[model samples]
Target: MAERHLEIEQKYDAAADFVLPELDGLPGVASAGEPEVHELHASYFDTADLRLAAHGITLRRRRGGTDAGWHLKMPAGTDSKQEMRAPLGRPLVVPARLAGLVAAYTRGAELRPVATLETRRTVVRLLAADGAELAEVADDLVTGCGPDAEPERWREIEVELKGGTPELLKAAGKRLRKVGAKKGKSSSKLGRLLGEAVVPAQAAAARAAARSRIAAATSNGKGPGITTGEVVLAYLAEQVEAIATYDPKARLEEEDAVHKMRVAVRRTRSALRSYRPVLDAERTVPLGPELRWLAAVLGEVRDLEVLRMRFAEAPAFVVEDLEKREKAAYRRMNASLREPRYFKLLDELDRLILDPPLAGAADRKARKELPLLVTRAWDRMAKDYASIKSADDPDVARHETRKAAKRARYAAELAVPVLGVAAKRVVKDAKRIQEVLGGYQDGVIAMEHLGTAAKRTKVPAEAFALGVLYGKEQCEALAARDHLSTTWSQTLGPSF
Candidate 1:
């Protein structure tokens, strides 16, 4: 079994002769305990290409520590990581459970020992006025060696919070820095060992700078003079990063993780479709179906999640059945994440960002080429809306319009950096159209599920309760239908 923890800590660089600072007078501190010494050794693992390290994840097996174990640390938030630990077992092999969490990044690549570190540490514990252990400061003298590199020695300080608040941590950092401690450059010991091999390239930073430049130009009423490929690739990279960031969270069943991952997938797929004039069809078209396939798998779990919330007040049996189905759907979704097909899809996305196959139009200025693409998306939604007004069965037409609105909304969002307020208005209007029709679609689906549940139940009371819920859902669906005309009229402000 693996135990999970939120690891919150800060690290600093220190000279070999740098002395520990006085900690008793810091905020919320009464006294600092005498130093305790320990010898620690850790072996770090990653894919041959260092994929995990590139994403700020660490997998290690450590010995001679109070919490010695096989640990998988993933970025949770600023200055914090979600760490999962299993008992230290095999000396060389990565634990199956921990490996499964990073399958999205590894994509079935073999994990191998990349670096090793041995640290001699002295720890001083900071205590509160009431004697609670608030935090621990470790002064570590580390000797690190990578796969083909010579051993390198360095000294650093680590302050890990136990029961302390962020303010206390900030105070401790202030005091440490006051005594000549410089903030650590690398995020981890392994990062310092592997050096530039694991650190992301400067190209990523350049892309971000380019995005800011384009947005600034557009905001100043000057056209973005950058190529369409630059704008589209930056947007695609962001969505792909989101997909990767949320993959492990979704696997761990974190709140809203599956929905977030699915939305990223949809955005990527939508961009590929809406920007086809600028992107090469030969390489991008096949990716659309693959992204859709992944989204459908995630949607299965996301839909059940929504229903579990919607029917929270329903009969116990009804909730229980939904919970059971939800668990099963989640298991299936998890299995799909580990499939070779899913891994290949992720690899393809990586390639698309790294070596984009751009068409002739991609060489044109973004401000000139992107607005037409966004307008085309808006036209698609308008056509679907017109079909809904004339169709006898509005359910199917509404669903089509809803999907078109989502695509248009995403398209406009992608162009906002290059089109300014004009694109933002389109985004705002398309979002309203999507939300109204989305509610109608949800009501329709809920009623169908309730009717199916009513038929499957053996007890009359449960069946009667389900029937009542179905009636309510039908009423809501009808109300949404009535609101569609009003929503459409109000949102008709933006045509692009």
Candidate 2:
């Protein structure tokens, strides 16, 4: 089984001759345990070009100490990381389970052994008043070797909290600083071994361009001026980062992971479509289908998740059947994650961001064109809402209107930084319309699920319960329809 936990720790540079400092006086640390020495060896893996390192992700296999395994570490915060561990295999290769999680970062790139660190670790546990261990501090003599570089040696101290607060770390650092310890030059052994050479060319170019733009903006006495390409790319980058951020949550089956992931896909597709004038259609238009494909697969499970929650009060048998369907849907969703097609889509997304196909329109300042784009989205949604006649069944029309509202909402969101309050107000109102239409569409979907369940069940009580659930869904749908016109008007009452 795979296990996960957060690795919260601090590191300080240590001279080769530096001696251990007293830990008993540190805040919350009552005493220190006898130091135990162990020899540890870790091999870091990344793309030949170091893609994972560039993104601040580390994958390694270690054989030493009590926690030996294949470890995947992702950045969590300033001084913490989330680590996923799998047991080491006999032959020593990256575990498939862990590899799947980094597919977004690696983009299925070939992960080869990049560097190896061998450490002689002296571990001292800091104890609390009641004799509970609060933290472990490791003083290490390290040797690092890579395929191309000669072996290098260094010394460092790592203060890792077991159950201690950050205050304890701060206190410990003060003691270390008194004895000539400084903050570590790099976050990890691998980082120091690779140095600054691991940065990808595209990443370097982006940073340089951003610096130049900021300098120019500073001289003009205004904040950085964003171009059409920058605005769309910023939105696109956000969604891309959202996908990366949510990957672990989705893999761990956290609440709303599937929904949030689907929304990222939808938002990216929406940005690509709405900003076609700025981005090259020939390059981005084809990605729409791939995004929809992913969202649809995810929806199979996400939709079932909502239905199960909505019908929680239904008969036990109906709820049991919903559970069965949800389990099956989730199985399919998990299986889809392992497919080559999904990883290919990730690779495509990476390529899109690294080298976007921008047109001449993308060069225009965002202030000149962003408002026009947002207004277009708002007007399109209004038109869609107006086409829904009162006498019509409205299911199809409501779904279409929801789609428009979603695009308008995301478009307005993209405009907020440049357009300010006017954009924010539109986003607020667009969200309400979207929610109303979403409820209507969900009700329609729930009623269909009830129909299907009724046909499948052999028991009379279950069928009757399904009937009652169907009626409730219909009533909810009617209510949503009743409020649609008023909500739509309210959403459009203000100008963009």
TM-score for each predicted model, relative to the true structure: 0.94, 0.91
Error of 2 at 344 (Å): 3.8
Candidate 1 segments whose C-alpha is farther than 4 A from its true place: 199-223, 493-496
lDDT by residue for model 2 over 328-426, one digit each (tens)? Answer: 987788788777888888767766777879987898888778888888888898788777786275667778888998999899887776677888988
Clashes of 1: 0
lDDT of each: 0.88, 0.83
RMSD of each: 2.2, 2.9
Candidate 1 lDDT by residue in tens digits, 418-487: 7778889999999998988888889988987888788788998888888888888889888888888898
In model 1, where is the ten-residue run with the lowest total lDDT?
201-210
Model 2: how far is 48 from its true place, Å?
Answer: 2.2
Error of 2 at 80 (Å): 1.3
TM-score of 2: 0.91
